[model samples]
Target: MPVLRVHLDSDRSTARRVLQLHQEGKIHHESREAAREQVWRRGHTPAGDPTFVGITNGRRHVQLLYDVEVYSDTVL
Candidate 1:
């Protein structure tokens, strides 16, 4: 898969929305180290090692590092 540099969005609101999705269960909470390994599951299974989610993106890293808590993730 082609890597997506999602940190391109500088709007804080957009990042906040992602956090809302996680809280509302619309999205699953993964981790911030996606640039090192696959971080999401495809489809809507919600039953596995990694949680299922929609389109796979680098949001997990951003979410972990910013919206949710203080953390570090490998830069893409």
Candidate 2:
């Protein structure tokens, strides 16, 4: 199966969610750490940089970015 890489600016909760989804058969991978690391590395690079921004209305809010990838069954 093809491996999918997901990028996100998240916390421990988000990481847990990703793992849960994988265990539930909702995703092809077991966790989001690899994807997270990939994003961080890209952000540190020069070309094709990746960044995450947060927005709020009036109240205080926290947001996270999430990237999900689906793989082919042939490779799974």
Candidate 3:
């Protein structure tokens, strides 16, 4: 089955940090609301700005949009 992907667009360092947090299971976003809230957190970027989030629903539709698996069956 396909999953929802939410990516926080930022500089290389910030992207790496977010990716690390996601991989380590520190961030758990199982819905669109949760993903928007968590992904656009303060201090996510060097200038203390909310990171830009790019979301997509499926895998076959896009080749480069989805980067992180942030949603699950329990959607809000």
Indicate which candidate wins on TM-score: 3
Per-residue accuracy of model 1 over 1-76 as CA lDDT, tens digit each: 1232212222345456655676687653333234123322211212123332222345443323322121233233
lDDT of 1 at 30: 36
Q: Residue 25 lDDT in model 3?
A: 56
Runs off by more than 4 Å, candidate 2? 1-6, 27-76
Best by lDDT: 2
lDDT of 2 by residue, 15-59 (tens): 456555645656423233444456445442222222222211223
Global fold similarity of model 1 (TM-score): 0.27
Task: Report clashes for each candidate as comma-separated counts.
Answer: 0, 2, 0
Model 3, TM vs. native:
0.30
| lDDT, residue 76, model 2 | 12
The 10-residue segment with the lowest total lDDT in model 1: 39-48
lDDT of each: 0.34, 0.38, 0.37
